[model samples]
Target chain A: MDIVVCIKQVPDTSEVSIDPETNTLVREGVPSIINPYDENAIEVGLQLKEEHGGTVTALSMGPPQAEEALRQALAMGCDEAILISDRAFAGSDTLATSYVLAEAIRKVDSYDLIICGKQAFDGDTAQVGPGIAEQLGIPQATYAVDVKVDENRIAVKRLLAGSFETIEMKLPALITADKHMNVPRHAGLRGVMAARKKEIPTWTLEDIEADPEKCGLSGSPTTVVEIFPPQRSHKTERLEGEAQQVARQLVEKLREAQLL
Target chain B: MNIYIDAEKCTGCQLCVKACPYSAIQMAEGLATITEACTLCGGCVSVCPVDAIIWEAPAVEEVDTSDYQGVWVIGEVGEDGLAGVTWELLGKGRELAEDLNTELSLVVLGDEAGELAQKAAQSGPDRVFYAEDPALACYRTGTYTDVISGLINKHKPEIVLFGATEQGRDLAPRIAVRIKTGLTADCTGLEIDPEERLLVQTRPAFGGNIMARIITRNHRPQMATVRPRVMQRLQSQPEHGAEIVEVPVSFNETSIMTRIIDIAHDEAAGQVNLQDAEIIVSGGRGLKKPENFAIIRELADALGAVVGASRPTVDDGWIAPYHQVGQTGSTVQPRLYIACGISGAVQHLAGMSGADCIVAINSDPAAPIFEVAHYGIVGDVFEVVPALTEIVREELGSG
Candidate 1:
């Protein structure tokens, strides 16, 4: 099995904060890390490779800085890394991103399986994986927590809002990894050194033979017309007292407000 | 499509760099440069005081949309008949359709599609299109996409709406790609652009830190998956009649690439649908230990509320991921939400902030959760949760 795990570098949204004064996101000093789910996807790929005996390749589409994320994937035991970056790819939505990625996966060719994070933390669309599968004309199982390969088929245990469903699909399919898939392992020193020395090629839109029209904002159907801070209520009624007293007061307030 | 900086108007204030959510703009040689990281969100365009950052939007090929009419909502069927989200979508779909002076239609696909569609017609859609087959019952991506996309291609609805549930998120994008159209995800707001007759979609990005209003320009059947619980469901009216259309599902079963092996519905794990719950009591890392979640459970029991968990708690194995309330987990809009020990991260807030009333209890007085909670108690969860449970048990006579 040749596994290709798609990854993305995202700003640590947990550390991101808004400036109360300017009402804008304080992006300064915020660190960018490999999306959490992508890390799990890489782990799934590596584990599958170990069990089934195949090479694992980590792929990402972002600026040059995103190569750092791919290197981390390699350090975590990926056999190879590839970065698909191009200026024309800027302003791409999930659809365009999937198109470019699907094209790149086609170029990778002869792959048995493709894995992607359930969704990027920042975008949280959860569309790219399925979109890529559709563009590739393959089957996909999203929010997969466990996957087991058997010969030419794989069974995926997927998570839903209130249930877990196991879906079986043929090879050369796509599966989006959920956070519960597996605990990701940290990169070892030897692996890090080897990854640093390894050559990871960067592919552009032209290299993937993607239609320029479907590569970026041009291919994107949705456009952001406005951006603003989410409105938040500042007024909070504090119940200042002992725990017992506060609890009583809360109950009383709830009763008075007809919320109890 | 051209994005360039006007050298004459550039003052290199670097505001765009700070304003950019993606950090796509940078100062190089005292002039701001747009990097490949830019998603063309046009965030920097507005922050530039000199208007030096110019974004020439790409020309969209003209599509004759006059042939496309009616607003169609993809109704979902869950373990319980028609999902509440279907009614919610119909409620909002009615408004949009009314605004556009078009008909509102509901498309349901399942083994009981006819029954579900009939049940949904009470919500007052002008039309209901249903495709029935056992193969369409369990929501295989291939069959669902084929059937819906086939219907969409045939009917040419001007706009399509879907609930941003797991099934919707999985099926909408595939259908959109198959039909060669754009589909926005998890929109919190949807409205019709009166002049252009476009769907204006507003959704949170960057984990609810910012809101982006999006539009599918020049695309027919402007499609978007709306967040559940955000839209209100209209009262069912028996007097309302709908034109029912039966769709024939045609697809090769052998051509389907996936099969459902088993569906294990863990009642203990996700028995309580957080989105549908009226009250939710959520625990966080501040609960101190995994075992301490019992206190939250007790409180939820006393109040007849569902138990929810913050991401940290779920990630720490203190609770199941199904109990998680946050951006990456579930976006819920219950009537009352009680947060215990949760520090109120933006991710968590993105989910339950829509609750009608919020009560937060934390030992730390400065926790961000207090900022959004309508009622705040600066006390330990161990102390406050049990006390509140006792008081509520007595007050509500639920003990």
Candidate 2:
């Protein structure tokens, strides 16, 4: 029951800024961190590894600095780590990204379960997980809040719009995790010390035997043409009066807004 | 263009056919098939429950590219002045126009929306097209689309941009369907390829994990909708010079179905203005109990901000759905976001991670929320939140 957890290093969006002049996000000084959602996937993978007595590998695709995310995963108890980095991978959209990731997963073919966070924080597009599933021609259960591994199958509780659906899928399936899945464990001093000595394998498109056309920006179907900050024009109507009066004013305002 | 359908993956959802609205998709042998009538709007590409449909326009072999003209932004003005999103679109329009070495224009609708037209002029657009009429006062999807589609037909703008607001969201899709064009929604980024003269529309897809880029390769007007507060608004300068061409429009009452019964002014919802709130204090399932939500309310009140919740908290009836933030909930961009006892799940993060600053307070140091938070405090939020609230209150009082 080898498990593969896919993680990404994203610009801490909170620290991300739009250069007013360029009208694009300023990624220069912003620190990078493991995508919040991926952390849960890593935790789940490590826990499953502990219980199942199998190897857990943390895999990521990004620039060189992405190694930090892999290291973090190793510190959190993943048995191994792999970083798929290359210049051509830059500017890849979800479509191309999934293609490359799927190729990388194929390179690590022995894994029985592949876990991913439901989505990444910076882009907030949940497309890649399913996109990878599509490219790999595998079944996927997204938004999994709970997962249990069986002898040859996996049962998962999927979060839907207003309800939960339990699904059973075969091994070697893809599962994108929701935050409710589990609380990720912290890397303690002992784990941190052990992580420093762990070896992280790096792979490029060629190393993974990926087709150059299908692994980078060229493989991407979409492109970005422009970006600008959203405009906000809100006229604040401050309410000031006695409690009952303020409540009355509030109700009147709600009525006007057609919400009441 | 070549259409690819993975029949093995197709669930025969018919969402693509229903969304077509153009009668382009038909059921053939228990599978959805694209007919010759298809205009390649790509609406079905995203709506598919399973990743079954794949449509690709043939690579531009013979590129005329000459007939496609300027970039036009559909300017919107509510009962007030120009909508904030319209100005943002103008700013983006300017960029796309420059990339293509073409001119930028604004199409304004509504009676006396000329003030906004003049404002659009200051954003450095080359021209302004005005269509003023009483019927255009309230947003009617059919009427507004009719007016804009008419103008688009008359002047073939190569690229068109719209704000992904409630109105823009409703209007753009309908107009795209009617005009047989492609429309992408909630784009976070955009770029233009100088060589191809194509507008690259990038947006978060699949909830918010990956950025998906969509392009209207063969469509006349490459249309995209940008979310509000995701773009910068240009400053209005009265002195900026521009020319406005007024177009006549006759609206028949039969075309409009929905009517504004009444425009009541509500204070409670309007006062919070969560969309624009600089500070947001949100609670989630970890709040322990529903009654403890008062702590979140207290903190939000102290900071003169809005209170938000996660889907689980809202599902538990601790708060309303409107207050929930996630993939299915509202996408917010605040200056500061404080999560009290929240576990920082991906769904909740999808909604609020766009904030400038995030502070996560949870008893578990291993909570996923801390991974994205700029400031993290590992402790019981029940104890930490009250103290933080008191400090904020004191600071506000002192100021």
True contacts kept of each: 0.83, 0.04
lDDT of 1 by residue, A1-260 (tens): 99999999999988877676787788887899999999999999999999999899889998899999999999999998999999889889888999999999999856999999998998889999999999999999999999999999999999887678999999989999987788899999999999999999999988999899998888888888888888875578999889999999998888887888
DockQ for all models: 0.73, 0.03
lDDT of 2 at B357: 63
Candidate 1 runs further than 4 Å off = A256-258, B272-275
- For candidate 1 chain B, the 10 contiguous residues with the lowest summed lDDT are B266-275
TM-score of chain A of each: 0.97, 0.93
Instruction: Report how far residue A29 has shifted in candidate 2, in Å.
Output: 37
True contacts kept of 2: 0.04
| Candidate 1 lDDT tens digits, B1-399 | 368888889998989888887787888989998876776778777778888988998888988988899999998887788888988998999899999999999999988888988777765899999999988878999998988898999999999999998999999999988887888899999998899988899998888888889988877778999988889895677889898999977666777899999999869656767867889999999989999999999999998999999998888788877888987677788888999999988779878888889999999998989888999999888888999999888878895
